[model samples]
Target: MIPAAVDAARAALADPAAVAARWRADHDGPVIAHLPYDVPAELILAAGALPVAVFPPGAEQAQAHLQGWICSPARRFLAAARQGELAWADGLVIPQICDTMRGLKGLWQFLQEPAFLESYNLPRISRASARPYFASELSRLRDRIQGFTGRTADDGRLRAAIALCNAVRERTALLFQRRVLGQISNLDYYTLVRASYVLPPEEMLALLGGMDVEDAAVSKPPAVPVVVSGQLMEPLAVAGLLDQCGLSVVGDDLVDGERAWRTVAEGGDPLAALAERTLNAPPCAVKNGPVTRETYLAALVAERGAQGVIFLHFRNCEMENLGYPGTRDHLERLGIPTLYLETQWGTAAAGAVVTRLEAFREMLEGC
Candidate 1:
């Protein structure tokens, strides 16, 4: 039986708009929409606003404002704002993850001009200076959120929010461990992780912790074990395709996957903790960190016992493109077969992707 918490999470991902609608019916304040990767959601919660994730799914509407080429996610999110899909969002926070996201922040402000908007600039490196810079950014963000919400986030409230978020992170990490042991299906695992983006940390923690955690080998041994890397699991269609194609995702480097949940905050200032956890989590395409991405990917591959790596990057994503050649070369030099899939938000070529994934599975099996 599916856990109730999982059910709630699934409901959130199924229709984030509906979740916001429900929050409106229940709560007394506006919702602060948070984009993916890194936005300190605790501050939003402390501001008396419901912090929700905004993942635009396509570029159809966004293309009108953008020229050249734009990544599917960045374009889609802007499209959501332009199309009134995110009209319920009282404010929006855009974290600086890459050039595409930076452009998105500008376009969102210039074109759509939401009532509340803040571009959170993030540091690309995890140097000693990054911590203070990030913490100050968080402080500034907190002030912006306060201005939007008209509520003060005292230290007590901020700490409370931090504790709640940390609990959710810890629970997600445990669920990830269970998934690594084959207790969870790649699709189920992906669904669970996607749920976290939309649901509040309190509810996510409940859902993640309430799982039965059976010994069901969703992906049996001898199935092709592979690690999937991407900006975010934009369309979970890939996980379903991988499952159908006989590929089991032993690990992932996606923003919503291992990157979001693997790290937890410890003692000290809440802002410092948030900054540290953000920097210490899995290596993102934009953030190289102290340890090289190749080293990080190698460790993940070894730890997960993966036979191959599948990099499913979205179309026109600059940061992912920057790191792709290096990742592919590193993995290939080590004799690990790597498949790079360039995807769009829509399913125009989904059948072709499935066929290619099936062939890749055959190759992994042969190896």
Candidate 2:
């Protein structure tokens, strides 16, 4: 049996809008919505509000509002807001990552005209000036949150929020470590992580703290271990499919997965600490940090004893596809097998994806 806490998290993820609505109805503070990758969630929490990570909605819903070729994530977010799936959120924060993402603020304004919509200028290149620039951007974001919530996210509150989120991240790291050890199944592992995106920190920590991985792993079968490097294991059923194919996802270099939690904010100044944490966090295709994505993926594979790497990318995601060739070549040169799986928003676990995974698993077993 899944722990009650984990089960609760799964339930919350199933209907995130309902969860956000309930939070807004119950809390005195506003509910803040943000996309994945960057955007300091601590500022939202510090404002005494719920920080809800808005996942992409149905692709078809976004077709009328955006070009069919626009990345599904960007399209879906716009559709969700217009369709009222995100109506409960008091405001939305969009970080400037790519041209498509940068244009979202204008699209949102022209299409939805939300009461409070703000954008943060997240630096793509990491340099000496990046930290200070990001810190200033975070300060601007804090002001935006204050404007929406009518409550200042003062330093003390920001510190408390940082400590709370940092604690949750710490516990989540432990959870993933347990997953790596075969103490949790892929479905449960990702489900618990997805739960963090919806559930408040205190509640998520409670569930994570109560997990008994020793019991959970008792009946799980051993499988070939591999690492997934991509945006996310979307539609989540993909995780279960991997398990069925005898592949254990031991680690990931996903923007929304392991990368988001690997760093903790430090130092005295909360904003500066957050900026440093953002600049220092694991390098992704979206950010030009000191470490390259290929290097990071290679290190993760070695650390986890992964025999192969699965490069999972959302179809039409320019940024994800742009960095793929080099990373693939790097892994191949090191004699590490790799597979490229391009997925659309709703076609996850489709026959083609399953076929590829099955073949990859067979090849790994033969080797």
Candidate 3:
């Protein structure tokens, strides 16, 4: 018999539209689109709206919508939005997470849709100046949300929203923790976690709560656990490749991965808590902090019990590419092996990545 959690997750995956429909029934508020790796989810929820992550699908018609653009990840996300795959949204929230995403905002702005639109900017680097910048950006976002929704997000209201969101996020984190502890396989975890992007957080949270896999035994010992970092355009391909290479990806710092958890900081100030958590949360190539990319990488490796770190940078992502050498050096200093793979934002390079990953696995085993 299939595990109850897996079965529940599969049901959600089979009819994501039904899930969206259910959310629409409960909440009459506008839907908000959150860009990848941005802090839009928390803000959307705080605004008393449903937060939906937009991504491109693999259908042929979807491809046609994005004909000129190479099959990049951004193109795929746009295609999905154009093809009605994300039609359930009442509005879209675009974040200035990176250059590609910034360009996407302009493209989306002129689409002439009556759907409400909002844009947010999160600090790229976690430096001395980043915290204040994030706080200000978040405050501006709160004002916009209030103006758009005509709702006041006072201390009491923000706290209630934060508590609900935190409950949902904590459940999600426990699910990932179960998988990371080797009680579940990467495939199973990916199936469930990826489904969360398409489903409403409440529904996803309930599904996770129904999961009873905590005591399940692993079929095999987890090989060196590794935390996947950087842009993950195609998580299905990345997770599949990692599994084939015999490395168990216990956790990740990616937006689409374990980092989606909502952080609830104490005090009456929700914006401050949100800003602090966004900066302190897992290592992202775009964050600004005194700690270099290498420091973040090393910390993730140790925290995740990962013997090695995989810096998965997308081709033409200059920020990550430029920081590669320093990141590698930092990992080496901590005696953590590192494998850096650069690729275009599609699964076309899966075969090659698998080969390199297998070699890396062997190298790790020999250590």
| Candidate 2, 212-297: lDDT as tens digits | 44645555678999999887778677888888888999888775578656655555988888888778777777887678988888
Measured by TM-score, how close is model 2 to the native structure? 0.94
By summed lDDT, the worst window of 10 consecutive residues in model 2 runs over: 210-219
lDDT of 1 by residue, 240-286 (tens): 78877878888888877887675546456777777887777667787
Better of 2 and 3 by lDDT: 2
Q: Whole-model lDDT, candidate 3?
A: 0.68
Colliding pairs, model 2: none
Off by over 4 Å in 1: 3-7, 57-59, 214-222
Total backbone collisions, model 2: 0
Q: Highest lDDT: give the candidate number.
A: 2
Local lDDT at 61 for model 1: 48
Off by over 4 Å in 3: 1-4, 7-16, 59-71, 112-114, 127-129, 210-214, 333-335, 343-348
- On residues 90-196, what C-alpha lDDT tens digit does candidate 3 reach at each position? 67777776776777667666553635777788877667688788888888888887777766767677777677767766777777777776676676777667666
Sort the candidates on lDDT, descending order. 2, 1, 3
* C-alpha lDDT of residue 172 in model 1: 76
Q: How many residue pairs clash in each candidate?
A: 0, 0, 10
What's the CA RMSD for each of the models?
A: 2.1, 1.8, 3.2
